[model samples]
Target: MASSSISNAEANTNQPRETKFEKLTKRGRENQAKEVTKMEKTRWTSDAEQQNYSVKLVEALSQRSHGNSSPAAEVSHVAVRETADRLLAVAAKGRTRWSRSIVMSRLRLKLNPNKHKKQKKPKVAGDMRSKKPVAVAKKIPAVERKVRLLGRLVPGCRKLSFPNLLGEATDYIAALEMQVRAMTVLSGLLTGTESLAPQFDPLGSGRS
Candidate 1:
């Protein structure tokens, strides 16, 4: 009997205790969902937190870009690609759809600097003042057509439905706002430094 009990205990030990996902009760499930949702909340929702994040983001950009590469590597000075990674980091909360779309698009551009090169402007298709509508253009609903144009503007949203694409656009706009704010703060700091002043003011204007 003692030997049988010992063997049974060993078998139980070998078996995984948490092998199955324990189904939560309805109330438990709701609580669990709330917890999960809270995990993805933006780190900068509060004013204090926003101020903190802005400071950290600028500090990070200064650390990453300072002395890491040659003057030529500052190609992103105009493109602002150097700030892309940090912007993406700030937007990463909740894995929002638009953030993902723009991040992927920008990442592709970052990996292929050639994509950033200015391309020859294509010839204008034709005059835009004509009041006579084309047959195919008349067939499409104005709302639908507008949505399609928005999809083109929001990267990775070509196939998304109108509602989803709007969500993406909203998020993308928010991310862009964050990027602008971050760049503004960083630029303010750099403006005071004499060494980098000329780069910002290539014309040699004393006041930036």
Candidate 2:
């Protein structure tokens, strides 16, 4: 029984212990994570440096603008040189150093920054004289305009032209004339009037 108990103790000792640390990913994944972290740090540094440079540039410009006008040209030259020096100092501390042309270009960009901005053309009343004459809209004839309006009102009138309208009016007048003649004859036949309906008897029975 003691030997069996000793074996059980040995078995407990031989079992693997649980680790406190988490398991790491593969080497490639670890390297990728490290690179991503490094890129983020670099991006943050670059953004901070850019913001610093922009602030310094604005301060320098404001100083130059507020300086004395008696020796304005000289003061501007001094400001440009000072700004260039500051930029060079910052660049030297960074990963990359700017070339002479690049430094000058940056200085010029800061000094003449308006050249990079989009310039809107000033609205001048005089520009109206230079503009091409706007073509006048053709005036629609009154009759044709009325006809088109009528066509919209009446679906059957859509195919009606000027000649068609005139012809339809003529036909309507003729139909009215025929109805009036028929009404007169019917009245004469009922009242036996000789003036409205002359006699038409055969063999000259009702003649004279």
Writing each residue's lDDT as its tens digit, candidate 1 over 17-68 gives 6433553466678898898666434433433344455555655555666756
lDDT of 2 at 103: 53
- Misplaced by over 4 Å in model 2 are 1-159, 199-208
TM-score of 2: 0.22
Q: For model 2, give the 10-residue run with minimal summed lDDT.
A: 92-101
Model 1 clash pairs are none
lDDT of 2 by residue, 1-208 (tens): 9999999999999998655442334565788889965753453234234334444554565577777576554445566656645553344343221223345556678899877688788889767765656453136677877877655443233556766554434433333343344335434654777686533321123443
TM-scores across all candidates?
0.52, 0.22
User: Please, what is the whole-model Cα lDDT of each candidate in the order they appear?
Assistant: 0.60, 0.51
**Candidate 1 local Cα displacement, residue 87, angstroms:** 2.2
Question: Which candidate should be chosen as best, given lDDT against the real structure?
Answer: 1
* Cand. 1 TM to true fold: 0.52
